[model samples]
Target: MMIHTEPGIIKRDGVYFCSSDSFTQDNLFYILWGAVYSLDSPYRVSRSYMDAFMLQYIVSGELNFVLRGKTFTAKANEAVLLNCREKNLYWADRQAVVKWFHFNGKNTLPLLNYIYERNGGTGLFKKNYTKKIEPYIDSILNEIHKKDSNVFSISHNIYSILCELSAPPAVLESPAEKTIREALSFIQSNYSKSISVNDIAAHVSLSTYYFTRLFSKYMHLSPHTYLLSTRLEAAKKILIYTFEDIETISLRTGFQSSSHFIRAFKKANNITPNNFRKVFYQKSID
Candidate 1:
């Protein structure tokens, strides 16, 4: 989508970057545009139609967003993802600093659908995940400042930011459920490292036997199976989205060896990793 601000709006101080045509043509996931604005006076923007999805985070003050004729207020540490095709208006309730990213690609719609389903069809919500999102925003801004920013790096950071947003809301977990959830979070964050079921159990301060039973009951899979599945899932995403070779992919996904990765991948997917990658690229090309 073209990037243009409405005329006759109050002036604000901001830094922004728009993706180049070459970058947009080659990347499946990309930020079409982004901006960080610090308003000295009141600011407002109205749009009848925006061609890409937008994620806006409030940094210091509050924003009043009107979408579908409903008004919602987002304050510091909160965010909203607007379906840009809809009519919307957002204005600062007072002087505020805000950061926003406009993103689109093949994966965007499906990811948005998943988020909407989990969020009860609402576009505004509190940021319940950890506080690492701000650093990611800084990283994106730094990358954009480079004379030749790597598209992959910026895109990957954007994906990380979205993943943080799309995480399920914080729930009050029972003691057992909390322990299991901690273990699962560890597995997800460290799957690429050389970690074992014993290590996972130890991190959660549980005996191997007890941990195995609890995990199975809660997750419907043994801890070992869960770790393996996590690794395999990471491998699959890398294979489909990146050009890393089989050996590199194996190492990155925590497999002991390329041959072992191949065997496990074939057993799980009913096709070799190479074949899976080929099929994915072929579909993208078609």
Candidate 2:
């Protein structure tokens, strides 16, 4: 497609860059990109970043992932779904080779659900594992290679991979509690700045005292506690996605001062903001 090469990204021999066409694919529901990684490659998840969910397949050697305080290892011919909403570290062994597909679209959730349901409510590699699933994996790659906008070949491939991985749907079916949901929604949308319980309660048309009680009962904390989590999450995103400093981040995330931001971030995430960024960058090979 006459795509231009960019610095800082590893391009596979056969895979094409999709960033240029990403905007055109908004109607695309989701996007897919393929890449092969060599051993000794370290890919760290961005701090405070949330992925749409991903699938990884080991073509050869082995890969290790540290996710949410646990370690997962996948060997050749095996595939796994990378979970969402967590900062993670992934690395390939000295001899490892891997092919990964990053997929996200309108039917992404549905596709994952279908796979999980088909696999008896578990994720992939649960049964007697075999190396013969390569053909199925190849089928997905072939579909993505089509790169057609009229038909939904890419979506189907993502659906099939979800089937192979047996990914699960969200466990939270309904909103936890009315007040809590409102508060959470407020936090997510407005976390770029300081917010207060009174502001949230007013948005939901409830008194502060009553709303605070309801928030604690359902959310297990007062509104301020939820705000901290939301603000921290936003701060993490800023650190990873942007190159702004602590003062900027503090103001953007509603912290009254940089000192306040540092204290809160260390308490919640167990690392200073600068250290978090340093560790995250250290993980990325590029």
**Winning candidate number (TM-score):** 1
Cα RMSD for candidate 1?
15.1
In candidate 2, what are the lDDT values of residues 1-286, reduced to their tens digit? 1122232223354563334255435544344466665545443333334556666677777777665566777777777665443455565544666666665665566656666555543233522332434564565566556545322555555545455455333244454475577778887888776678888889888899888888888877788888888788888988987889999999999899999999999998899999999888877746
lDDT of 2: 0.64
Report how far off residue 32 is in candidate 1 (Å): 2.4
Whole-model Cα lDDT of every candidate shown, in order: 0.80, 0.64
Q: Which stretches of candidate 1 lie over 4 Å from their true place?
A: 1-13, 22-26, 173-286
For candidate 1, write residues 104-221 as lDDT tens digits.
7767778887877777666777866426577777777767666687777777877887787787777877999989989999999988989999999999999999999999999998
